[model samples]
Target: MKRNSLLLLWLFIFWSVLIWSAIDPKDYPTWFLEVFPALIGFVVLAATYRRFSLTPLVYLLILIHAIILMVGGHYTYAEVPLGEWMKEWFGLARNDYDKIGHFAQGFVPFMIAREIVIRNKVFKSRGWMHFFLLCFVMALSAFYELIEWWVALLSKEAAAAFLGTQGYVWDTQSDMFFALIGGLCAWVLLTKLHDRQLREL
Candidate 1:
């Protein structure tokens, strides 16, 4: 019962943040671009809950990612207040909240992919599994950059906010690099805990 209540609370918080994000954003299109993945994730989780429920750590990470998405949607990544605060405090070149989003993009998805791969016994060799994971995460990261490019071309009005490039010529490249780093770090930092959780699951 307590576990069920906690799950409900988790859902309530997600919906609350999503609603707040949707009420009024920096721009409607940019909001959709950012929040769409969270919406898809919610659907996928619901669909798989009974037959293939993920580990609690994965679920928690997904929620955190969704919250990051919604927050970025509400303010647009370049103008996020938290990122702005950090930028000023640290004397940085630009708001880097988008980097957080990119990092989570790699980190959370790598966990999900690793869980799915391990649970299914997809690779006989650990080395091969790691290789596949790196490829998958990097591909995902690069594809997302392509998405930003395509979207920028489609909607000039929302391009700047949605892309969150902030006049940096290498923003897209850096985003992918951060994602690669995130993926590598996640594998190093999370493999042990994730393996324990997999045993429990």
Candidate 2:
């Protein structure tokens, strides 16, 4: 199949699932709101699909990240079924799947930035690239936290569901920290892989 066609197919599947999830009564209101970014990202990517050829690994990562968001939306993060089950099995205090989602929010975006930087040759300084990538992920996380705060101010109940703190006093701090960790991990894991993918492209 043509690359553009494949991209369209993937997008169609994503949106179909999203539309279904949006109307599903079992999902929390925050679920749809949380998915807003991914939906927007899809539209942006689709618009540029013909001009870009992303690595299969990057596509897989994006899909995984989207699924994480969808799952969090469905269960309101703190009460995610899988996380709650894991918590019970491991005897933890609360569900931690939301952490995973937030981490990927940074992790996946790290590769997206890396792809853009390498593909565009945005900067000549390799060390600075990594530094800027870390800073970028942190800034993104902080901005998201602010968004959460704003949502809380506007709609306390819905925002509580969106925050998905699960009783952690340092939820916001930990979210950013995990995102930082994920950014580092993405750099470590995808740097060489992305280089290889770039060569193939």
Number of the top-ranking candidate, with lDDT as the measure: 1
Compared with the true structure, all predictions reach lDDT values of 0.92, 0.83
Error of 1 at 109 (Å): 0.6
Give the per-residue lDDT digits (tens) of candidate 2, residues 88-117.
899988898988987898899999888889
Reference-based TM-score, model 1:
0.96
- Give each model a TM-score: 0.96, 0.90
| C-alpha-based local distance difference test score of model 2 | 0.83
Q: List pairs with backbone clashes in candidate 1.
A: none
Q: Candidate 2, 68: how far from true, in Å?
A: 0.9
